[model samples]
Target: MTQPPLTTNQDLDSARLREAFGVFPSGVVAVAAIVDGAPIGLAASSFTSVSLEPPLVSFSIAATSKTWPTLRRCDHVGVTILREDHGEVCRQLAGPVDHRFDGLTCSVTGQGALTLDDGVAQFDCTIHEEVQAGDHVIVLLQLHAVAHAEASMPLIFHRSGFGRLSASA
Candidate 1:
């Protein structure tokens, strides 16, 4: 019998590390940008509130994502907080589609960013900066205009499925 030698300090496997991160509950956000006058978007759970005073927010996209490169080049960006009904929207955006905006209810902001249909919350943002961090680009944005939905209960992602908010105990 033969055995392979182990490295002295091999750190945690990235796959396991990612799975560990999946344990955290995060809000589902759709990052939309207009390209050639059409809206393109990708679902992300990386969104975060950066500041309250200046009204800033942040989200990270993988540097290797082709879609991110295309969307990042646009001047206008919108972060739409997904509703429970948006699970399909998230899947569609992540899949291959001739047009991501197909059948999506949207209205352009004053700056021309596409706001999703009845999003829980839509943040019209200006790209402040994108800093390279590890394998992803942390997008820093300044909230230009904020719109809230007629109701609350923003969509959430957990353990690989869409989640609904449980009433506070």
Candidate 2:
């Protein structure tokens, strides 16, 4: 069998790179906390588990994110893995900053971390480290506590759209 030749001279334009990156499916998470007596949060499709030894997870946020700048100052952050039915909620999160949590049910931890009530999983975490990547910052979160609804299916972001795994998957 012959392998296909790689395109060495391909132009790595932003649009092309984003389209290529969207080919892979990823789970959506809401990273939020109470900042200045209000709920501040953002939706991230780049959330991933990073380590088990120290119990860590990670998500990448654009360096220009205004929400992250404020949310990161909190002592604790709540990471909520959204359920399959949360497509609209995800959109709202990415919408206007002032209305992000409007009409949504959430729980605030004693330390002010805020998690959506209907999420598939919830994690209480603190910033462990931050790495500067190209146009983004990789945040390493050290887990303090976690809870998950085993029967709930996660919302998936794929091909620049929201979806869910089939029952047969």
Go through the candidates in order and give the C-alpha RMSD of each one to the true structure: 5.1, 1.2
CA lDDT of 107 in candidate 2? 97
How well is each residue in 1-169 modelled by candidate 1, as lDDT tens digits? 6776655676779886787788888888888877887677788899999998888999999888878877777777888998877788878777774666678888877666777867899988888888999999999989988989786777788867888888889
* Local accuracy of candidate 2 as per-residue lDDT tens digits, 1-169: 7886666888999999999899999999999999889999999999999999899999999999988889999999999999999999999999999999999999999998899989999999999999999999999999999999979999999999999999894
Candidate whose lDDT is highest = 2
lDDT (C-alpha) at residue 67 in model 2: 89
- Please give the distance, in angstroms, between residue 88's alpha carbon in candidate 2 and its true position after superposition: 0.6
Instruction: Give the per-residue Cα lDDT of candidate 2 at 52.
Output: 96
lDDT of each: 0.82, 0.96
